[model samples]
Target chain A: MPRLRATAIIPLLLLAASAGCSAPGANDDDAKSGSGPIKIALVDAQSGQLSSLGAWELKGARLAVDEWNAAGGVNGRQIQLDVFDDQGDPTTGTTLARKIDSEGHIAMIGTAESAVTIAMAPILKQAEIPNITSGQSPGLVAAGSEFLFLNGPTSTTYDETLAKYIVDKQGLKSIAMITNNGSYGKGEHDAFLKALSSRNVVPVADQVVTTDQKDFSAVLTGIRQKNPQVIFVGAEEVESGLIVKQARDLGITVPFAGAAPQGTPVFLDTAGAKNAEKTIVSSPYLSNDVSDASKKFAAAYKAKYNEDAELHGAKAYDGTQILLTALKSSNVATGKALADAIRGTKYQGLLGDFAYDQTGVGIFATSIGTIQNGKLVAVTG
Target chain B: MQVFLQTIIGGVSLGAVYALVALGFSLVYRTMGLVNFAHGNVVTVGAYLASTFYLTSKLPFALAMVIAIAVTGAIGLVIERVLRPLENRDFDLMLIGTIGFGIVLDALVIAIWGATGRAVPSPVQTEPIDLLGLRIRTYDLVVLAIAAAATVLLVLFLSRTKRGAAMQAVAMDHEAATAVGIHVGRSNAIAFMIGAGLAALAGGLVGPLLYVSPALGGALGIKGFAAAILGGFGSIPGAIVGGLAIGVLDSFTAGHFQGYSELVTFIVFTVIIMVRPTGVFGERTVNRA
Candidate 1:
C-alpha cells in the first residue's frame, strides 16, 4: 500500500512542479513572434509600511494601461499589467524580479523603495528586462544598470536646485539637518550636504537617526540649541512630518525643507496643517494643476481613484505612459531592442520631458515649492 | 542646563510609555512563565480601537480610551483561555505559539485598519508649557502623570487585594497555589487581563504622540522587552527604573553622539546583561522561597 501511494504521489508532484514553472511568454516561439498580450510586471510594496506608494503606483499604472487597452492597446494587442507586492523589502524584490523574469514579463515598473529597486537592478539587467522605477535615490544611478530607468529626477538634482534657491536666492545661511540611515535618506543627506558645501555654508547641527525611529525629541532638542534659520529634513513623509511636529512642540519655529516626500499628502496629514505650513519642497511635479495637460490628467485620476493625484502617482503615470509609447513605437520589441527603443523615444510627460541619459536618469531639474494652507504650490518667479 | 532639562523630561515621558509596556511583559512572565510576545499587538490593537472610536464614531477621546482598555482586557482573557491547553506543555511550544499569535493579531490589525498610519488626536493641548525656562509639551506631562498614577494603583492593588496576592502565589508555585485553595487558572486570567489593560493604556496615551500604525507594535515591542530584561523580569519598580534608564540613555546618546545612539544604547544593555545575568532586580534563585 505504501509503495502504491508513493508511485501515485511522485507523478502528481512532478506534474504540479511543471505547471508551476510554466509562464505566459516562456516559449521561444512566443518571444520571437511577439504574439499574445504584452506582459508588464508592476512591482511595489502592496502591503506593509510602504503600501501607500504601491497603491498610488498601482492606480496610476492601471489608469494608463486601461486607457491604452480601451484605445486598442498598442496595435491591437492588449497590454497585460500584472501586480507583484514587494513588501518594501529588498529580499522580496529580488524574488519578485526572478519571478517576473521567468514569467516572461517584457518590461517592469516600480519597486518604489530605493533599496529594493537597487537590489533588483542587477537581476533585471541580467534577465535583459528593462524597468522604470519611481525611486529617487542617487544609489539607483550608482547601480549603473542600463536596463534600469527612473521616472523622475534623482535626489542630486532635487537637492541642488533646492540649495540654489535657499542659499543663492533667499540666502538662508544657518541650517540644521536631520536625516535617517535608509538608502533614500543617505542619498538626500549626501546630495544636500554637497550642495550646501558648494555654497561655502556648513550646517550648525547634523543629526542622523534610524529609519524606524518614532521619537524626535532628543534630536530636536539638540537642534534647538543651535537655533538655525532653517532645518533640512532628509527623510520620508511620516518621519519628516514627525520631525516637523516635534520641532514645533520644542518651540523651534524654523521652516523645514526637503525633497519629494515632504510635499506628499501623508506628510501634510501626519503633521497638522498649521505645523506643516511654510514647509519647502523641491520636486519635478509640484502639483496636478501645473499645465493644461496636468489639469486633464488630474481630472481623470480623480475620476478613477476619487482621490487627488500626488507626485508618486504622477511619476508612475508618466513612467507607464513612456513605457507604452516606446512599446508602440518599437513595434513591441523585447530586450536590448526594446531598451534602445525606450532610450530613443522622446516625449513630453506630466513631470517633464522624457529623455534618458547614459545613467538611466531621464529628468534633471526640480522646481522649488512650499506648503501653504495645506497645499503645495510652486514658487512662481 | 535648559537643554539638559528638556532631554530628561522628554526621556522620562517616553520612558513612562515603555514602563507601561514593560509591566505587561513582567505580569505575563510571572504568572504564566510565558513571555507573551503578543503583548505588542495588544498595544497596537488598543491604539487602533481608540482611534477608530474617537475618529470614526465621534466618541469622546476619554470614552474611546475606556472602551479600548476594557475590550483589550477581554482580549487578554480570550488569549489566556486559548493557550490554556498548551500551558502545561514545553515552554518553547508556548513561546512559539505566542509569537504566532502575535503575527495573526498584526495581520488582523492591517486588514481592519489598513496599513496606513493615522494621526490620533491628542486629548491634551499639544502646545508646550514654559517650566523653569525649559519648553515641555503638555501631552508629555500628562503621559508622565498617568503612568505614575497607574503605577501607584498597581502597587497598592498587588499589596492589598486578594486576587493580586493569589497571582503572586501562582507565580511562585503553580501546584502549591492550586493546593492552597487558590484558583490557579483564575489568577492567571486576572494577571493577563491587568497586564493587557496596562498595555492598552500605554497605547492610548502614546497614540497621539506617535503615528498609530500596524508597525507601531514591532518598534515598541523590542524596547519593552529590553526594559523588562533590564528591570529584572518580574519586578514592577524595577521595570519603571529600567525603562527610565533606557529612555534617558537613548535620548542622551542621540543628543550627544548622533549617529551612534542605537549602537551605544544596545551596547550598554549587552554589557549590563553580561555582568549581571539575572538583571538589576531579578531574584538570584530559580524559584522564589
Candidate 2:
C-alpha cells in the first residue's frame, strides 16, 4: 500500500511540474511579445434582432485575426478577442463599455447601433480605450472624443452624396422625404435637408415615423399629395421596403432613393424584386467592385462563410486590419502606443486608402449602388 | 387634414397588428391566469417559421402562413404541457420560467436565422388607393380587414361554441369546472394553442410590413402585455380597444414629438394604470379565501 501510494504521487507531481513549466513559459512568451496577448473586446447586438450584423462583424474580425496569425501575429503576440452582446440597448452598451474598459483590454470594437455607440462614447473616453465602430451617426464623432473612431461614413456624408446624386444627376427638383424618428433617422433627415439647402432645393413634404411602425399609408399619402419628383427614404431596410411597397400600392410611382442603411440585401429581399428594382441607395462599399483585392476578399469570405459579405462586414475586416497594421508598425504593445499607431495608419484597404483623421474617423472612400434585378449593382454617378 | 387622415390610417393598420398580439395575451390569461411572457417570442418563432417555409421550402405565402401557425400552435401546446405541472408553483417562479423560455426561444431563433433582420415580402402591392381624397396602401386596408374578421370569428367562437364555453368556464372557476366534466386540462391546452395561433397569424401578416428579426417580439411583447392590462387582463374587447388606442397614440406622438415618443407612450401607460387599477374593462374579482 505504501509503494502504490508512492507511485501515484510520482505521476501527480510530474503532471503538476509540467503544468507549472508550460504556464510560466506561456506567460514569459506573452511578456516578451508585449502584455501577454493583445486583448480586444467586441461589443455588438450579438443576441438581438441585429445579430446578423453582429455575426457579420464577428466573421470579418475573425477573418482578419486568422490572416494576421497566419502571416505571423502582430509583434509575435497572439490576438485575443472577448465579445459582449449589448442586445441593441444603450444602457446595456454602457455597462458593457464600463466592464470592457475596467477589464484592461488593448482596444474595443463595436456597439453596432448608432444610439448604443453614442451612449458608450463617454464610458470609452473615460477609460481612455480606443473604440472603432461601424455606426454611421454623425453624433458619434460629434461627441468630441479623439479615441472614438467611426469606421463608416458619417450620416451627413451619406445624405450629402445621396442628395447630390438625386438633385444633380437625376435633376429632380421637388422631393419628398420619409424618415424614422430615431437618432439615425433624425441625423439623416437633417443632413439631407442641409444638402438640399446647399443645392437651393427644399423638400415639398417630410414625414417622420417610428422604427416599430409597420404601416406607411399616411406618409405615402402625404408624399403623393405633394407630388414630389423623387422620394427619399431615410430609414433602415425593413421600414424602407414597407414604404416602397406601400407607396407603389398607393399608385405613387416616383423614383425612391434611400440612405446607407437601405443598401443591404434585406432591403431587396423584403421589398421584393418589383419594388426594389429601381430603388437607389448610397453605400460605402460594394461587393461587386471587381477590384483585385475586393474580389479576393469576396471570394475568400464566400468560400468560408457561404454568404455574400455586406459593407458592415467589410468595414469590420478593414477596421481589424487597420488595428493589426498599427500594432505591426509600432514596436511597443501598450494601449496608448496601439492607439497612436492606429491614429497614424495609412494602409490600403479593400474599401480604399484607409487613414484616420485627427478625430480617429476613417478617411476611407464611399460609393453608390442601386438595387437592380434583386442584387446590388454599383452605380457610377 | 391629409396628414391627420394618413396618420389615423397608419395608426389603425399598426393597431390591427397590436390587437392581434393582444388577443393572444388575453386568450392565454383568460384561460391560464398566468401571463406567458414568451408570447411575443412565440410570434417571432412563427415569423421565422413562415420565412423558412417561404424562402427555403418555396411554399406559397398562404400555405407558409398556415404551416407557421400550426407549428406555433404546437409550440404553445408543448409549453402548456411542460408548464402545467408547475401551475401550483409560485407566481414569480412561473413568470421567471416564461421569461427564461422567451430568452431560449430568442436565442434559438438567432441560431437558426442569424440575428440579422430579414425582409418579409408583403403579399400586397405598393400601389395606393384613394379614399376620401387620402391615398392609402391596399395592404393596410387588408390588414385592418383581416383583424376585424379574425376578431369577429373569435368572438363568435367563444360565445357560441361548446368548446369555447368550456374554456371560459375553466377560466372562471377551474375547480368548479373540473367538478363538472369540462376537462379543464384539455381546455387549457386548447386555449394556449389558440393564443399561439393568433400570435403566429399576426407574425405572418406583419412580416411583409416590417423586417423580421429574432428580437422583433421584445418591444411588441411589452406593448401587448400593456394592452392586455390596459384592457382589463382577460377582456377580449378591452384588449382590442386598448391596442388600437396605444397604436394611434404612439403614431401621433412619435410623429409630433420625434425623440420623446417612448417617454410619452410610457407616461400614457402610467396614467392609465393610476386612473384605473382594474383597467378600462377589467372586473374586480372577489377573493375566495
Candidate 3:
C-alpha cells in the first residue's frame, strides 16, 4: 500500500512540473497574442512621487478591462494587461516601452506622466503599437505619432484660450510661472508664455526645477519678492502641492493658477486643504457636478476601488473604453489600423466626447476649476 | 531683509537634515573603512517604517519613532554582518555591493509602504512662528533643535564615554585598538547601529516638512556625501559646519539664480574639492588611492 501511494505521489508531482514548464510558453506567444486576447501595456510612474496619480489611472484601466471582460472581451478575446513601473523617469519609460514593443503587445494604455509618455511615444510608434495616454501635454498629440492617442486635452490645444480666459476674464496680471524641467513642462511653459505674450502679458519670473525636487523655498522666496498677482505652476499634483504649501508657509498668499496642478486630491493632501484653497486649475475632467456618464463612472469606480476618482483615472477609463471599441470594430486590424480607427471615431466617454483630428489631437470637455472646501469645483471661464 | 532671514532659516532646516545624513556616513566610514552607500536608503527605510507603523497602529509619534529607530539599528547590524561575506572582495566591488543593497532596500520600501509619498504628521503643531522678526515654520525649529541635540550627544559620547573612546580608538587604528583589549568587531557593529539610528532620527525630524518618499533615499544620500566631504571626511564638527555652509549657499544661490541654482551648487562643490582637497576640517587625508 505504501509503495502504491509513493508511485501515485511521484506521478502527480511530475505532472505538476510538466504543466508549469509548458504554461509560460503557451502564455508568451506574442505574435499570436494579438489574435487571441488583446494585450494592453501600462508603463507609468507606479512607484515614486507621482505614483498616486499613476495608481488611480491604472485603477481606471483595471476597471475598464474588468468591465469589458465581463461583457465579453473585444472580439471574443480576453484583454491582457502588462504593467511596469517607469518611476517617472523618461529613460525608464522608454525602456519599458521598448520591452512592450518587443513583446508584441497589441496596444498600450499608459504613461499618465507627459514627459514619460512623450519618451515612450516614438518607441511605441516605431514598433507600430497604438498607445492611448492621459497626459495633458499638447506635445503628446502634436508630435504626430500615428500610434499615439490622448484622452486628455493637449497643453497648447486650448492653452491659449485658457490663458486668454485668465487674463481677460479673471482680470489678473503680473503672472509668474514655475515648471518642471521635463518635456511636458517645457511644452506647457512655452505655451503659457506664448499665450501670455500674444495677449501682451509678460511674466514676472519663469523658474524651472527638476522633477525630483521637493524644496520650493528658494524659488518661492524669489517669486515672492516679485509679488505677482497669480503664480502659475506648470507641474503635476504632488509638486504643485508642495509649492503651494511652501509658498503659503513663506507668507506669500498670492493665489496660484496652473494647468491642472491643483485639480487632484493630492494637491490638497500635500499642500494642506487650506493652502490649496482658491488655487485655480484648468482640467479636462471635473471631479464633481458632471454628466450622468461621469457620475456612473465615478460611482462604479468608488465602489470598486474604494477611493474617489481623479481626472487622470477618468481619462484612463475613457482611453481604455476607446481602445476596447477600436478592438471590437476590427477583427484583423494591425496596430496602425487601431490608431486610424481611434482617430476617425467619435467616442463618448465619462470625461466627454473625444474626436482626434489630423494631428491626432483630440478635444475633450474642459473647464477651469478651483479648490473649494477641499474639493475641485468647476468655475465658468 | 525678511526674505534673507527666511532663506537662512530654510537653509538651516535643510542643512540640519544633511548634517544628520553626513554624520551617519562619517560614522560608518570611520568604523568599517567602508563607504556604506546603504546609509541614505536606511534613512528612507526608517522614515517609511516609522510612518507606516504610526499610520497603521495609531501609536504615539514618540513611541513609533523609538521602535522604528530600533528596527533600523537591528537591520544595520544584520547588514554589517552580511557584508562580512565580502571580506576579501575588492573595496570597489564592496562599495558596489553596498549600493546594490541600498537599491534593494529602496525597492523594498516601494514594495511594502508602496510608491505613494506619505506625510508623517508632525508631532508638534506646524504653525509658523515669529523668531527675531522672521517668519519660520515651527517644524523648522524642531528640526534644528533635534539635529543640534544629536550632534551634542554624539560629541559628548565621543569625548566623555569609555565605549565612545574605544570606538574612536578602533577608528584610529583597528589592529592597535584590538590589541589594547577593545572588541573591534563589536565596536564596528555599534558604530553601524548608532549611524542607522541617527539616520532614522533625521528622517523622522524632516519627514513632515518634506513628505516621505522613496526619492528621499537618493536625494539626501548624495547631498550627505557632499556635506561629509565639505566638512572633512571624518570630522564631526566639520559635518555640521559643512552641511550648514552648503545648505546656506545653496539656498542663497537658488534665491538669486532660480533655475541655475542646482548647477551652481555642484560647481561650488567641485571648486571646494579643488581648493581644499582635505576639506574644511578633515584632519586625516587617509590616502588609500
- Predicted model with the maximum TM-score: 1
RMSD of 1: 5.1
Q: For all candidates, what are the clash counts? A: 0, 12, 1
lDDT per model, in order? 0.85, 0.77, 0.78
Q: Write the per-residue lDDT of candidate 1 for residues A1-381, one digit (tens) a residue.
A: 123224434644553465467664444335335577787889998766777788788888888999999999987899878777788999999999998787667899997899999999999999999999999999999898989899999999999999999999898999999999889999999999999999999999888998877667778877888889989999988888888888888888889999999998988877878899999999998999898878988999999979999889989999999999999999998888888888877979899898999888899989999999999999988
Write the number of the candidate with greater TM-score, choosing between 2 and 3.
Answer: 3
The digit string of per-residue lDDT tens for model 2 on B180-200 reads 999877988998898999889
Q: Candidate 1, clashing residue pairs?
A: none
CAPRI grade, predicted model 1? acceptable
A320 Cα displacement, candidate 3 (Å): 0.9
TM, every model? 0.94, 0.87, 0.92
- Candidate 3: where is the Cα deviation over 4 Å? A1-35, B85-93, B131-133, B285-289
Using Cα atoms, each model's DockQ against the true complex is 0.44, 0.43, 0.40
Deviation (Å) of B187 in candidate 1: 2.0
Scored against the true structure, residue A172 in model 1 reaches a CA lDDT of: 94
For model 3, how does the per-residue alpha-carbon lDDT over A158-226 read when each residue is reduced to its tens digit? 466568668999877789999877666777798899889988898998888765565667778778889
Task: State the TM-score of the second chain for every model.
Answer: 0.96, 0.95, 0.94
Shift of residue A247 alpha carbon in model 3, Å? 1.0
For model 2, what is the error of residue A269's alpha carbon versus the real structure, in angstroms, after optimal superposition? 2.0
TM-score of chain A of each: 0.93, 0.88, 0.88
